[model samples]
Target: MASKMASCIFCKIIKGDIPCFKLYESDKTLAFLDINPLSRGHALVIPKFHGEKLADIPDDNLSEILPVVKKLVAATGATEYNILQNNGRGAHQEVDHVHFHMIPKPNAEEGLGIRWPQQKTDMDKIKALYEEIKARM
Candidate 1:
């Protein structure tokens, strides 16, 4: 984990090794403007702890993330936005760090465009899967 943190860009930012357009910072989290933004006021929120995925982060470290994102939204005056978090390379997560994107959607052409491929649902399968997951939870 120490070695990974040393190489991680976000960790570098957190450690003050890399400069960022920092917006907010707390003991548990940090918020800053995205260098390569999808839209104006596009920003990122990250846990201070070095975790590659959401499930890897402690709940205490995650507590301030959403509130900080919310503050950024208000501060940026963004009326429409998408809060995005990807888990792995397969999920389009380029950085191997647990971070959330607050992408402002100014219009139809910009910011976190995605396709929702709706699949036909089988009720029995859905019920069975839900029951299985619920039991685990």
Candidate 2:
């Protein structure tokens, strides 16, 4: 089965059933300004094929999403940007499908602060972590 949403909000936008402040598009991909943007020109890029999660998507379909994002970043004149993807309810993924949020921070914009819980780690433990990953290889 294809990973897609018949009733998904994005699908509606792609189908032109809903309106979006669009910036760019191709036969396979769509780019539009996020309605509730983190900042101005915040855009969402998605494949026409809808997938609930990243692993559920085909490689070629996933590949098409980013080049469109790069084009938006350059067109918007954003010097720095972030590509954010979320998955699962626990991950704060409000949208179920695989889409990339391209957030641009022009010179005047304040960078979003990531709130991370603090944890203490010893050097030996950190080194053991690297060794463990290497062992898997």
Alpha-carbon RMSD to native, per candidate:
0.6, 2.9
- What value of lDDT does candidate 2 attain over all alpha carbons? 0.81
Query: Candidate 1 lDDT, tens digit per residue, 1-137?
Result: 88998999999999899999999998889999999999999999999999999999989999999999999999999999999999999999999999999999999988889899999989999999999999999
Scored by TM-score, the top model is: 1
The global Cα lDDT (0 to 1) of model 1 is 0.95
TM-score of 2: 0.79
Question: What is the per-residue lDDT of model 2 for residues 18-100, given as tens digits with 9 covering 90 to 100?
Answer: 99988877887888888887776789998877788888878888777878888988888888878888889897788777788
Steric overlap count per candidate: 0, 1
Give the alpha-carbon lDDT of every model.
Answer: 0.95, 0.81
